[model samples]
Target chain A: MTPDDPKDPAGQHETVPGTSPGASPQGGVVPDSRGEFTPVRTDTPVADPGLPAHQWRPTDVDPKLEKRAERQVAGMFVAAQVFVVLFVVSYFVFDIGGDGDAILGLGASTVTLGLCLGIALLLIGVGIIQWARKLMGDHEISEMRHPARSSDEDRTATLEALRVGTEESGIARRPLIRNTLLGSVGLLGVPAVVLLRDLGPTPGEVATEQPYEGAGLANTVWADGMRVVRDVIGTPIRAADLEIGDLVNATAAALYETNEEGELVLEGTERLIANSKAPVIVVRMEPDEIEDVDGRENWTVDGIIAYSKICTHVGCPISLYERTTHHVLCPCHQSTFDLADGANVVFGPAARALPQLALAVDDEGYLVAQSDFDEPVGPSFWERG
Target chain B: MRLLNRTAGRLSRHRRRPVAGLLVLLLGLFATGTFYAAFAPAQAETTASDAAQVEEGRELFLIGCAFCHGTNGEGVLTESGTQYGPALAGVGAAAVDFQVGTGRMPLVQPGQQAPRKPVIYSQDEIDALGAFVASLGPGPAVPEESEYSVEGLSAEEQEEAVVRGGEIFRTNCTACHNFDGAGGAMPRGGYAPSLKGVEPKYIYEALLTGPQSMPTFSNGNLTPEDKADVIAYLQESEEQPTYGGFGLGSMGPVAEGLFAWVVGIGGLVGFAIWIAAHSTRSLKQKGTTE
Candidate 1:
């Protein structure tokens, strides 16, 4: 039976333009070509889906409004250029690892660079959204559903439609916007490469750059006759000052050093990095309380001993002292060191003993280093041995 | 010639009889005894002054401290048979001076720890008490005020003291008191009180006495200069201005994280909502006017 037959019910329903995709109650009453009533089956409920009438955007209809929106979008791209330039300037101008240049507890380099880059990205995103909402062509489109399997002729027609849509987008015609967007996005890559410089100072450079010879990862600022000063205030320690059971954090006296005019000589990053590695804890116990370590008999001066503050496990400054037991704990990972027995690892994951500093009294009565720590301090690394 | 002849005669006599040699040795011993007797009074005089102070301190101890510490200051037990107070006989002068000087003892009520309060006893009474406590047994003696003071030190020495003080404070006190000396929690109910407004003299006493759970930083341990350095660090910390903005108690990362989220992110979120609302209103108004 032919579907175009005047009595066919299914062919009649397909002709309705605005009707919802469902069967009408009166559908089955229509007679078929064979003069019998046929049932029309549909899973969808019947309802009239009335779509709202399209309203024109002001920028779509008014030439002046459209011109304003185009300029506004271009302005955002211009603002993005400013932010990108700021990001580059911030990279060079701000001290990345210096004291007194922190904002919100972060380095000024970190805060300014992040803000500039973030704003640059946000501007590009906002500009694109504005361009789409106000300047781009506005129209409503609807397409009827086709069968899953397409004929050879329909596939050719779909490709032709895509070509037409691309032309209507007008991207190539708007050279000003297209060029500015490309420029801002391309500039973002420069900051990415610039930020990579923060990875760290090159290997072997730090030691060579130091003013004091042999002062670096391999050697601390301590040397023969340099007084062991208190870490912050820079006061020299005396052997007679500390009593048994007292633990004091100390550093190389070079940190507190001043020029002839009395101005601080180590004022910034150089001082910070050097002091962190050179920190040590001085503990005093009775001469009898200490166990004799082979070859280290004279390391202690009147029951006072010095050990590197850096934990061997992960290089955290270890200072939680149990005076009675002569144990010091690292808060970072619970690594415990027995100070009396040459600072041997007693618990947790540390594998080696903390480095000990040989001590002597200077001519002026303050505690001074007999020499630098015998071994490299801090966490064990491949080149450490 | 006559002296030489006499010496030869005595030597010949000693050789003939060993009793003559014994008589010479006993005479030498008697001469040494006379020399010791002349010097003994000078040493005893210094102790006599200390003994007078101890005698007066004993009377004050009976009236003020003997109730909980025992009549002999030997410590006592409670009704339940538990040791209510520890024996203070051998704690020395430093312990008594620190406990009473800081006003932690003569405690109104007993708790896990004694808090610092206004001292009830006069300064002389406190010193007398210290002397009596010292006489009971040998222990760490009280340190003089000048021992932990930077007043007479040179500019360089004073600077060194402050720097060393910071180092010592970081190593010893930061565990319980925090980096800023704002105090922090202990394992149980105890806490390290803030050192912000504490007197320097009191700080020295606190180290010497090791009030509560704090271990005594004795002359043998921290040393007088070490204690002075610690005091300098504390004073420096108080004088320092908050570098950036509000320190938020200098609680470190946790407080900073909270401020960033609430103020920074919340401001951005509020700005976004305002933009969204304004955009919708303008769009609706334009459509209606058209």
Candidate 2:
């Protein structure tokens, strides 16, 4: 504490008559902790340089230049106004249909109105920016900063108030109420968990009516002796019809089967449920090209092999077949499978080789599935195990 | 004339008995046959130009393609067992037209694929080459213009054709050619060529032949009408000006997402730089730097 004044308890400054704490920036004698004069060597290598001299913008120096800048900013604002009016005019001038050529594909009114509004907004923004950059203030002002921390007394008072509030609330003392509140808050999540169940039936239940050997993701509608029909046409494919390099997209003939009155065997939702599972790509390559696997030797008929089109990585259909190489690639991800081999995964994200369908020919020489796919088709699930 | 006169002199020298005369006639026929063999090709070139197209094509093929494709269009193989050129037999005139007409053949150099280039052969010469290859085996014939053209369909009919074609193309072509026919990558270091601006005739022939790594969609799999419908769909989609600016190769999300990351973020960084440049600190630094 300075001996000169009792109010200055912390001794922030020397008892020097005229100089304040920061008034003397360089070497100056002041009272230290011992109350003795101490010469402080506070010399800086570089002089403390303050804010640079503000350069005058052309608008600031010359009235003529300032007027021109004002005019330019005004011009942009006027252009924005004109576009706003044009936007309204175009909305009336062009129709959504009929003469749809406002701007290739997008309806005339839609493109024009959108373009005009977008431009108007952009112009107004640009005009405001230009006005600020040129016509408005170019001076760079520094905002003085002070310590953000509160005073020691104020900090102590706040902490004391918080402690009192907490003590009165009795949150720590009331364990029974706290535990029950936590329990109720946690149980609130039950409704949300139950709501998600109705999103759809289990992926397998759709085909429950028919007691097919495989259930849900495990099986498709393909059965023994089922003809593999061409995709969109639903016509049965003859093995002879496929050329050496031909990759035919086929579905099970059961999807197209008719009953006594000729109603489709699987209609609407049943067909939709079964359709994705049933698609198989039948590719014909030379017999010598195929890499033989045990038990799969009879699966191919005359160098023709059938594989599930769905990718093993995700369920994207795999049909990009290269004839000479006998590779089929999935477009979703570049998962390449060698169809000539046992549909082995040759490249990319697919973990397993595509499921192979045992293929045979019917009495009429039409290609047919000997049995269902050997395993499940799509991506792996928790229940797959 | 001298050859004819010599043959006649040889005929006269033979004996003139019943059995001997028959033998003499055979000798004369042999001489005439030798004379014709020596001069007929030249005469065929000079007199019957229309019939000599295949012959002319053979000569051109020998000069341009024989090194890799052999003298008889029988393919050659490398020591590695990879094809230098596959045999042109049973590949048809349509295959020849697609390969050569599109300038994918007479390969610049052997590689994984034959990329499209400027057509070197004239239309007439291409026809002759096609004819020559067709003569090698009974392959598909070149399609008539009417078969591939969709100009005959009414607007409504074309719309219906497009819908049908879209389904067929999605089922068959979308795996490689992509949903928009912008094309996608294939196995190995191969690519499915973009179908944009491709002629309907070449599209037809390509579907028939399969070309390079592409699988053939045989006539049995997709009928001629179905093939035409695919062409119709492609043409219709191409004619409808792209809805969004810059299709980004129509590679779907991959390219569009890449563009967003590059350009969208790039624009923000550029604005940041401008703001930094105009800041009070940088402006002061700029004054001192000068």
Candidate 3:
């Protein structure tokens, strides 16, 4: 550290007890004026424990034993080779998948290939380890560690060399060039930071700008009258079909948009985005059991109540329902919501209740969303206000 | 004997009627009734056997289950109102079949959960128990084997069902049952049991019954076809070997990651210690003072 640099915590040895002033090799560890080496520590907190006496291995003293060990290690290496051959042979001999019978629930080929290759590698590793342990030149060698810091003379010489180079280059005298070079080098990192913007659009940008109306963080494509369909199969849920204690993972039918050719119009990323926000789990309980949320009296058709599947805690899709208790648990963190009581958080870390999607039945008797969620779904953010 | 008595009583009542008329009517009725009853003894035997089975089931229940379940399967409650055994009134054939078939009922002792134990009841006894419960009220009936099997589906359709079932399983079953149906933890001390090697009929009944903490995937929620698909997938999946590595308990990444980190890293750490501290032969210590 430069003595003139105020920011640097220079002369730290003066404050720290373990590292006294002269103990620092950076200032060059020198002898006191008495012409004798000054002890680095006169009062040792603990005495240095010397190395214990080493024991001799049987293979080290006995020639016959050493020969036997050498043969044993060689045998392992030979066995490794045999397994390697077996692996190669098994490749051609065994039928994969459905053709041959399974062994212990594993395919014939998988079992043989895996066992052979695995044993070969295991043998090689063990052989090398045994050879190292038993037959190699084994001695307890103490390596004296050198001081980590460079010599004071070397440090001074390096500083001097750097000073001379910089002076010759006129960098210190030419502040204009030096500052601009620093500025340009620092600016070079900006592109890397700026490139991260392409990870996705800003959260609400899709809602404000995307062609699909209200499809983003603040809104979903689940508009009024959109049929609630099964998550993967995309079959619309008929209200009559759902019985008491039944839980169905569902989403808006808008997610299954198609073109004339029967290809999904909402393909890839667009569908994923819309579907993520609109995941709904429709569950039916006895109508008498429901404790209606204020102003949401008509939200349920019969006993069928639909709510967003996304957890209020961190947005993991939750549908581990216990129909008897009317409790739904989130697997990620045990946040439980009482579906009978307006989807309120009865336990765990969820700060807000699960957002409910009001539902209606269409003329075709399919369950449909009355509207998008009144409150924003999922984990809270700073800008949620 | 009862039928003969009823016929004799009817004859006495019609004693004042014309003799020919009474004789002709009695002959026609007796011949048709007797012939049908003899040939179709099957129909009459079913009703008789059902009543007999229910009676036998009731006797078994009184001996084994009544201590907790009460005399008529009308649940017994501990003083605090916590259910000792929930009422079996509407639980029906499916619930009784799943609980008894899995050997979860007739609990050795009460606990937070009923783990799968050695099934004490024979198949006939279990069916009798199921029939007894079914007589109590209308609820889900025990599923037939055809409902939960791939017997009717074509090979191509079976493959399609497996794919569909995988998706459904991930959405519905994976949270508690785990990704590979190896089972995982529940809210308190309860756990979802592994679906591995479980009979297809039991799986179907379990879905219908909502055994323990498992939610009901009723025929309505997961249609009969969906249930069949799930069973087909589970059966097929159990037969297939793990490709990547050890199943590692199949609790998804948590167990697998813990295993790798603890075993792999811990092994390396122990190896490092071994390398540092061990040597086969002794040092001479000639000029090793430094």
Candidate 4:
């Protein structure tokens, strides 16, 4: 089957015998022994009925103009090399944050390194294009048709085309474009190598800055005295307000803030993170019904106690309350906890009990935290073991 | 010799008095025997009627419960003295009916406490055996049907009863069972059985029976209709469609997010990748061929 046949799977286009695929069928166009030639057609229709005779560019006619174009292309390549060098220098000179020099709100190292690397790549690209267009082969060649598969002759022809293209590009004759094109591409490697320095120091500095001391994956904003409040509304709960069997979804007070107008403030990602971490399930039982944990006698005001709504398994919030049993169930994975028994894991895949938030009645009678959780809340961690 | 013979003759005459004394002692012994026979302890001599009831109850207890509880109601003690079947000595008739009438007594095997099973014993038999056991020691009594019925409650009283019932539900029920009465798992293989679809009578019986892991709620603990009110709430909650989209097991947001993430996002990512690969191949094939 012919390569260009509609049903052909491979991309090769067929060539007619006696003439190349690009040869004109008219006399004087190259033809083979059969005296027949295949005409090549451009995709565009003969608009303007074929334009006025093509005007030769200056470089096509004047050798000096071509030489100057080659030189200009080479200059771009040399400049690219300079920027690559600058990229390496900036890597060493800039103090990422140790010295704290900021450029346009970014660290000096980041801006300088990025700028130099970008310029270096851009110059390399421009230099190559200039060499190809201004000095590369302008003359076209035609060959006789052959089979689609690359025969020995076709392989030799391809190699010849590549050599012809390089000569036509004038890389050998025009030292300026040739050297700059080579230099620019070679320099491109410098930016790539210099950028490696940015990756640095294998392990990162321990995140020991503000709000993150010794606190890794297991820690959150929860601490002693953090009041349990409604998630978005931030309203503090009074034990008296909740009747028996009521399940209130709540979060830590720190999740909410007040605007200047005294309006509640919870916005963006901050609100989302706080809501996820501090979810609490509040339930009211008979005072007698609560199985008081040792030393947590006053944890509940009246019969209301709050426990981390986050499941001790994979952290699904639990609100399925079986009041008669004083059990709160994590619906995900069916982890059941006895709220009365310190939210101890009574069932399911949960490895530990839901952490109970020790609660107390403030002077104003609102429920407040007596203390942070005695242990970490949510799923157990490897470090914790 | 003549004086000794006369004294021996007088002593022989006095022998008549000794024989009369022997006859009086025999009469006293007969009278004591009759008195003792007349007033023997009432409990020891089971009357024909009491005997008949005890015999009937014993038959029923053996047929229905003796396999695990033991033939004599002493409970089958293991070598370690750990009794698998609790001794029924002080567990009164109420306990028996609550257990057996609720179908919780004759457990096939220990599981998450057997739920109230259908009673295999007749009411009269349950009571009779209850009495027999109660005779052993004072224990919790089974409540009559009358005790379970709420007395002449006004609208306000009913409302208050329900409100208190809600309180009880939150405190005791909400832990293992959901606030909505959906059942939850318990420690080990046990579970807090769902309150949903449970009949009010069944709820009352369950509380009374302490079926399975559930602790019994005697009259001293939760009144009968108090159980009824909680049952009522559970039934009512079931009838109402949970507001705001699907309840997603009524487990709240985290599960919803997980469903969305694992199931929803996973499906989306899979679909996206399929579409990407499909479109890339199809579009490129179309471009190259056509």
Candidate 5:
């Protein structure tokens, strides 16, 4: 029936076999004859499937069992509430400090918080489950399935429906779905144990490989006797050649080629990796103008010297040179390096100096490294301390 | 005719009488004036002494500078000083020339740092200026040029030179001039000039003559062409331009950020208020219609 028809409050229409309106069902409520009328049903019948033979819970059939079940459920809830109180006490009692009475090396505060909260939540979960099995209603019922989509009233009606459905489903009497759902959710703790694998890699796996040995956080491919060459060109430099105020961008010679034995020296990704780590800037001042840093008297050849071009703040490639001041500036953050004074950080965000590459002339008069940088190059990393 | 002859005879007699008297009076006045003009032996002796001093100056030069400046006081190419010093040849008898001549020889060092010092020679030695350097090859003498003379500069020339000078200044001097000519720091505690109130000659000398830590811009290194360009830039363009906004020294990003925060963002906020007011009016109108 149309909502406009006042007489048909249920909004259901009834029609004669051949006519469009004015129809009624036998023994149902009939509307007026004015053509804006229809029939409505007040009591809808429920189809029934007969109940199975009674197999009652021990609590339901015997009064002694019922009293015991009530005590058992209450006991679980009381135990859960006690654990919650213990959780609060542990938060204040733990002193995580240098004494190191930590659980599993975690601070006392961390261990206590995790354990107390975990046990508190677990006991409460167990209490609620015990309550349902021992004390909640138990019965069997049959219901007809309704359409999946619900009316606006169904939103408000869902609680009642769930209650009725629970009675029919016999979740309380069966105990299987109830106990297993509770137990499965509770046992989720076991996988947390399994996930502790991510805490650190196992001792002797990829970490034990020799390719990464000796090289730690603070070292690179730079080393003694390594020839300094033009970065991409790979031609070695003789100190006598650079004019005053000249700046040359160079890299370690090892980045360019391998030894004759056909062994992959500077192999695969190593050359690409070493190229980044070994970048250097060589500047020439007048021989008399060079200021010698203490203990680095021989670091320069005549007046030519090399320094790591990587800025110590964030490892930006730096090449801006003010020849007159002997200050090499990083364009990225303006970190100024004093090339004459051991490439010390004179200004800007850099925490440390651009590390100087000690230079010595080989027998052939080509510039070679006396040794690798005394300290690490590039942005400071954690182990730098 | 008879009367004329008689008058001539009378006039001749009168002439003889008056001429002799007039001649004696004239001679007496002449003697007094000459005696007054030429005084006693003491005055004569002072005059004679001055001439002697000048002669002595001539002699001193013969002994000292004549070997290089010739016997007639001309400069000698083969002289000891010639190997090092330029021919003083025609630097006139000026105070500056005199300062240079007396054992100043080759300067203790070149460049702008040269300072004025005492002459090692006597006054007689300095007085020889006319006979010594002047007697050498004749040429345009050192003029008493003014210390400040950019006045003769044409506006167009000043503008062009200043622009060109700025370029050269950036390439060569900005490292020291600091882009704004504020004079940035230099290596080993040296520094460049402030370019403020610096004299033209000092700049010329600093360039032609390398001073202290500044490298020499000899004709060989920076051609006169380059020096002129630098001078033009330094003299004319140094004053801040009167643009409609703050210059902030033409230091790029720092000034731009200051401008944005002070002007651009401020304008945006002001516009936003105006727009908000307009929007409120429109919203009120729409509400009334609704």
Candidate 6:
């Protein structure tokens, strides 16, 4: 075999001295596979240019300037620490919900916390930039072009190279520095773990009281005789008003309850949680249109029925109703329920029927609940024993 | 089984008349009864308190509504088989009130839909028209007078009403009419109109009649008090202050998030760019001095 092809072992062995395999020999000739020799030209049109001349920074040239630059960088870091302190102080200084703490319509607490935290971050970033530009090593370095693939020899010697590097670093002898570095890095993870507490109390911890005291997962604010009020404006619903083919979004009247002082009985998060589970849709259809589902016959007040709005499929509030078919479709997953037939799942991914609320009208003509839902409302997982 | 037994007993008792003749007689009676029930003129006028109002409404209907709607308020069906306007006979005063009060009636010309506009008649004339339309049939009536405004309630009740109204508005109406009552796009070409400056009575009537493609919120579905709460919320919302600085049109989180990203991030990026430019210029000067 002629000695030109790099892939050919016999050709590599027969290559001319001082010339690379696959490269032309000094006579500008390369051998062919059939033992014939062919002339080749080896020339490059362009030459590689080296990197530009290095310029010295002010800190690199003068000792006084170098010391001043170091002070300025340290000052920025110190200012960052001061801003962090300000952030902590602001957390306690400003009132979150109380009166006279708002600044330009935003909560004073929120504004101060955000501003301090942001400034601290900005200072830290600027300090790091200053340190790198004015004080840290700035010597220019370059590496020669080489194949990305390592040779077998270099691959085998990697462990030995690591050992030599470690020895040169003197980390094994510097016990104080090494342990302190490890301690600081490990301690940084504590704040991240501590912040996880803000995700809210566990389901078990949330109380299950009625009349607006509990978490939504276990119970709602629906009480015996609590009028089913229209959502938004706490107006009581009268049974005489609804016509056939009408659907109304309704909620428990307890949401509008106030104490003697006129403050809400269920305040803040409790109100929000109770309201989430309390949403129900009241729909009216012809009495003949509804199929009698055993005991549910008494649940309707003159052909009007109420059911929880939460879709059993992943808990989206469903209200899209097709009056002719008595089908209420969940827009999120297209889960359809036949409201006339006891709110049964008619189509799509819902695995369970919507929980129906038993209805009764008070002497005042307002629609009221006979009792709480017989079964827990929402996703089937909550109903699991 | 009981029905079958009764039929057999009737057959044995009826020996003089043949079963076929008896069957024909029963069928004729059933057909006549159904036809009468289906086509009978609405008998709601007997329930109306004011006959004079109904009489005035009839006169108004003759002058204005009868051109498209027949003199009997049965609506015209062209020779081409298209209904020029819908029958107003059984739609009642509630429908009449909503259509006329909202100024969607006296349609300039029939097309895909009628839009709300300035009313062509005075309040008295409108009421008369409503009474006339209502007198023709047994349909929903104009509800008794309601104090829909929050001014009627105690201070505490007013606050609670506003809160509840806000909750209701956000939950139900916000899907089509946005959080601030600025309406949004509906499915197809229609839109839920903005609640701004709309009369509370018109809102109540719209809920009952379900003008156009909107689903009806009947008296039983949304009680009178509930309708009042909705009205209260709509009225209160227009006056409510935007406490958290910029409202961004109360278009909800999507629009707010977009604005935050654009202006907030853009400003930050511009500052960073300015800092970088200043730093580089200073570095060049230092390099020249060295």
Cα distance off (Å), candidate 6, residue B251: 1.9
Scored by DockQ, the top model is 3
Q: Write the per-residue lDDT of candidate 1 for residues A1-385, one digit (tens) a residue.
A: 2334333433443333333333455442455579655544332246445555656667765667879989999999999999999999999998765544367654677778888999999999889978977867655777554334455477789989888876787667888988999999999999988888667765665433455644567777778988998666577887887766666777898888899999877767777777777889888888998888998898889999999999999898877676546877776677888888899988889999999999999888899989988888888776564
- The regions of model 5 sitting more than 4 angstroms off are A1-217, A258-272, A287-295, B1-268, B279-290
Candidate 5 chain B minimal-lDDT segment of 10 residues: B279-288
CA deviation > 4 Å runs, candidate 1: A1-212, A221-241, A252-276, A287-298, A313-325, A329-336, A341-352, A359-371, B1-94, B103-128, B137-176, B185-191, B208-244, B258-290
> Native-contact recovery for every candidate?
0.15, 0.45, 0.42, 0.02, 0.00, 0.36
Question: In candidate 4, how many Å is residue B258 off?
Answer: 18
DockQ for each model: 0.10, 0.23, 0.26, 0.01, 0.00, 0.16
Off by over 4 Å in 2: A1-50, A53-75, A97-111, A135-215, A254-273, B1-61, B122-128, B145-158, B187-189, B243-290
B19-48 per-residue lDDT for model 6 (tens digits)? 778897999999999887776534444445
Give the per-residue Cα lDDT of candidate 4 at A268.
61
Worst 10 residues of 3 chain A by lDDT: A7-16
Question: TM-score order of candidates, best first?
Answer: 3, 2, 6, 1, 4, 5
Give model 6's TM-score versus the native structure: 0.54
Compared with the real two-chain complex, what DockQ does model 6 have? Answer: 0.16
Candidate 4 residue A1 Cα shift, in angstroms, is: 14
Model 3 clash pairs?
A: none
The candidate with the higher lDDT, 4 or 5, is: 4
How far off is residue A316 in model 4, in Å?
Answer: 5.9
Residue-level lDDT of model 2, residues A187-234, one tens digit each, is 999988888877877645643435542347777889899999989878
- Give model 2's clash tally: 1
Query: What docking class should model 5 receive?
Result: incorrect
lDDT of 4 by residue, A1-385 (tens): 3444443334334333334443443422355478665433223234235334433445556667678988999899999999999999998998755433365434577778888998899789868866766667544445555546555577789999999998898887899988888999999999988888666532222121223311333444566666667543356776566655455666777667578997646566655655666778777767787886888887788888888888889987666665457776666687778987888877889988777777887777777777656666777665565
Worst 10 residues of 1 chain B by lDDT: B278-287
Winner on DockQ between 5 and 6 is 6
Q: How do the residues A1-385 of candidate 6 rate in per-residue lDDT, one tens digit apiece?
A: 2333333333333224434445644444455698665434333324335566666666776778889988999999999899999999988887765433367766677778888999999899988988987778766789544334455577669978989988998789899989999999999999988888668764444434344354546677787898998776577888887777687888899898889999878778888877788889998889888888888878889988999999988988877665546777776677889998888988889989998999999999989998878776788653355
Docking class of 3: acceptable
Worst 10 residues of 6 chain A by lDDT: A6-15
At residue A195, what lDDT does model 5 achieve?
92
